[model samples]
Target: MRSVQRVDKCLAAACLVISRHAKFCEGARAMRLLLVTPIYPPTRGGIQTLLYQLTASLPGTDVKVITAKERGWEAHDASSGQLIKRVWVPEVSPLIRNAMFNFAALGALYGWRPDVVLCGHIVASPASWMIAKRFKAAHVVYAYGREIGIRPALAAWALRRSNAAIAISAYTRGELLAAAHGATLPPIHVVSPGVNLPDDIGRCDASRPTVLTVARMRDWYKGHDRLLDALPLVIQEVPNVHWVVIGEGKIRAELERRAKAAALLGNVSFLGEVDEDVKESWLSCAHVFAMPSRYPEDEAGGEGFGIVYLEAGARGLPSVASNIGAPTEVVVDGKTGILVDADSPPAIAAALIRLLTDADYARKLGSAARRRVETGFTWELVGQQLHSVLDEVAIAQSGP
Candidate 1:
């Protein structure tokens, strides 16, 4: 059985090679790559997850990650073929942060002298640009929505200087291009964050009306307050509704207080900082996933792409997200999920109520949502896309 499975895997690889019209398996060869980010795993967030995924995906690639020791880099090593170097940066003050970041980045570049640098945050933009300029190495920047939208001048400079830039969603790409304002921008690509779909939605009852949202309890960008405000109306419409909130943040206390104030304490469950297994269980158990993220003052603090929506969708669960930033890209309006106007509590409430009340409609949307993720949003596919981008950049840089 094991031999047969191995044969099947080999055949699948052959088919992929043929389909892609490749002369050789480009991924088999090791390439020197540097990844810079603000955060990394054991620390929860999209950027951290993305960096880990990118590095882990490329097996033979010599990958190194440079990040600030904000919470202290844990669950990674510098000697496991994948190097993780943490620099102490005072995140509180801008002046100190910039100085520390520049010094640290320069030290990393000087020591490693990697072939390519893939920066994961805009805070590292200046350092990345300088390293690329000085060493003449290929630099690629990953632009999440908030970073690109907030630091327009820095983003523009990085976009112009970097060999290429990757946007997590089409919305982000559009915003980046708009910010550039006809300036010759680098080659930009959209590679949506991927989610691992569970084999079975364990112990979940589809008939029950359960709503899930996996977002930090932040008052501004995450819009948990708005969701809470909308809950009363939703409960009036679908009285049996239950909400599961899976995340931890500074605003958790405030949100809990608000839930009590709004008379939603009994209906809402706060499961703080759940692991992957627990998150999957909740995703499978829930009927719908909702996150109403809103942009905070046109700053780079909006949802670049709500990956939780896809995680829920992958489990044949529909989503109800705000029509803002990358959530608009993640959730297909009326198909995979509903997209309501940002900051409109009534609109959010109405959408959630509609999904809970209409069983058949919700099921259909969920089915479509699952199929969408299965088709294009898996980590395997995302890794392939990134591999191609890296190969192209490498080849271009090696040219006469």
Candidate 2:
């Protein structure tokens, strides 16, 4: 802690010097914004999607990305408007990859200096702060729930140094506050993720009432097991109900085995990691979207903001989600979707059954959800909010 304080003091002194010399000419030229993230598109994760959407949504802002190289990234970048620089780092070790990425980010800032630097993930936080400080640009850091929850000290350190911060949800904001541990922090804006309203994607098989869950099976907190447990009860009520699972991870084989053991093979289909169009099509046809994520026993991690719920909601599908975490904020209980105790298989089962059987009620909720997304959760709105924050921070950093 003492060491941290000393480092903070040193950085603070350096910042005082940089602010006087930092020249920000904003009116005539487009705002040059640099995004430093560990992962980018074709990686298929929430942060990647968020950064990608952010780039597309901000029209006048000149956006550039610095991220680690990923498979098929070149093809994806070829079609993009913004310049994306992929730093080649060995994928075998995360520590090496992150360390190399930071070093690369520091040296990579050669030709163009951005007016603002946004760190997409915590791994890039320090480098982002240094770069922003060097340019006298506004430094912004984003906080996601699990990352902060798992490493409060690190989160606190990053937040203290930033000019501003963005939290994906109120739940994530809470996590950031807790991480501060009574220490002062920068203005933390709660910017819930936005979803794209999909085109008329074709539908899935409607032979039976279908429930869909889209989440990586790598973590236990996503509550796939609980959903699997609820399936038997749901099957008892609606025997022909089909449960389609998307995403792939190490634990998928185990979840499949558990489903098989529970005699849910006939009812459940594990379509591991399908294309985006296919996932959207399932969302369009599925009667209910369910991924009842629960906090682990240690309470170290939970959903920051369940974007999948909004995605399903965008497709006019009512969700059955856990009553805890950011899902409560995303899925309005008894309004847009049914929220239940994720630990209680019966509760999950009941919600699923209720949505499946009562078409009128489900449709009402689904329609409301679609309307909610249309009004509040569109990417355009997200971009505007973010743009405002960036402008505010940049102006403040460039004092009169």
Candidate 3:
């Protein structure tokens, strides 16, 4: 059984490599893809970023993105030469907003008549499936961690309806299979997120520990509070340890208040919504990247592959991520980085301490992590995998 599993993995990796090379090979035709995402560029989040990268990588493909235009965003324009369309919808009142946006998306998709519709996130899946059904177009759904957890009825319906489904991590794929309860749904493709590595690598010093986390200031899911709680313990072990958080969200002020209350304000700094250069700099300078994600009741948001882990790894920086959701796949325990129990302050702090004290060990993990991503997770690779999936769906749909 173990040998079979190993063979399967090896085959999958080889297929990925072959497919990637084929995409760059001569005489490759790009498929017209319609991406249905809840949010797109100008909207700040991992999913949005992933869609942006995927669209950018697929050359010669007529890519059209359908997304909601939240406040502070201008009306959509195809200025980038990509077919972009935005439907203005109310951000407030979830019920009405979803209904209106989905209806608008369906209308746009029917009129545009894309060869395939790729929906990002389960919430958008139902609408994408509906559009596909109405137009008899092929449909694929992208499931992140939270969408597959415990399997909500709507998510299940969406998955069952789509021609194929893509999960960001193995952890998420397992959860989705379990949710299906032995019932065959769609073909599940595990495509871990990718990150652009920096050209120059930085050195990690054991004496002056630098801990960094790049995530929105969302509540328990991002685990800002838990990181704050662990700070005191980390500071006790390494007095000069500094924790830097990048990105901003709704809970920014509240998290700041909590950090101040815990007397962690001095040790922690919040650098809100940093640009790519600054983010890469932070990842390079940091000795360890930590994120202790906790499952929230809503389950709409949770750690999904934690692309920041890959970003950190690319910079030759080891990480300490929580043992929850898709983070387990991104941070290889005792290999790429340390994985600790979720929401446990002491466990998180201890992991940080270990990484800070053991410079050689940390460097080894960082090197391995960087190699892992470079070998498997690259935008070119991801784009190739996606194109292959699209081709399969298109062929299957055109069957006699």
TM-score of 3: 0.84
lDDT of each: 0.79, 0.87, 0.78
- The C-alpha TM-scores of every prediction are 0.85, 0.92, 0.84
**Cα deviation in Å at residue 270, candidate 2?**
0.7
Name model 3 segments beyond 4 Å from true.
1-29, 70-81, 109-112, 148-151, 202-208, 296-301
Candidate 3, residues 354-373, lDDT tens digits: the string is 99888899889999999988
Clashes of 3: 0
Residue 204, candidate 3: how far off, in angstroms? 8.9
Per-residue alpha-carbon lDDT of candidate 2 for residues 1-400, written as tens digits (9 for 90 to 100): 9999999999997886555334433345677899998888979988889889977897568888888888998888898876988888886687777888898888777789888899998888888999999999889998878988777887888899999999999999988998898898899999889999877634454778999999988898898999898888988889899999999999899988898887889999999989986887788888889999998877686899999999999988899888988999899998899999999999999999999999999989998999899999999999988887887787678775
RMSD of 2: 7.6
User: Residue 303 of model 2: what lDDT?
Assistant: 92
Backbone Cα, N, C clashes tallied per candidate: 1, 0, 0
Candidate number of the best TM-score: 2
lDDT of 1 by residue, 1-400 (tens): 9999999999997776554433224644466678877666757787777778777776446787777775534544543346777777775677577668867876765466666788788778777767766767689999888777667887888888889999998888987898798999789999888877677755466455888889876546787888888889998878878888899988999889989987888889899998887887787778888888887774455788888788888988888888867788888998899999868999999988888888899889999999999999988788888877876776566443
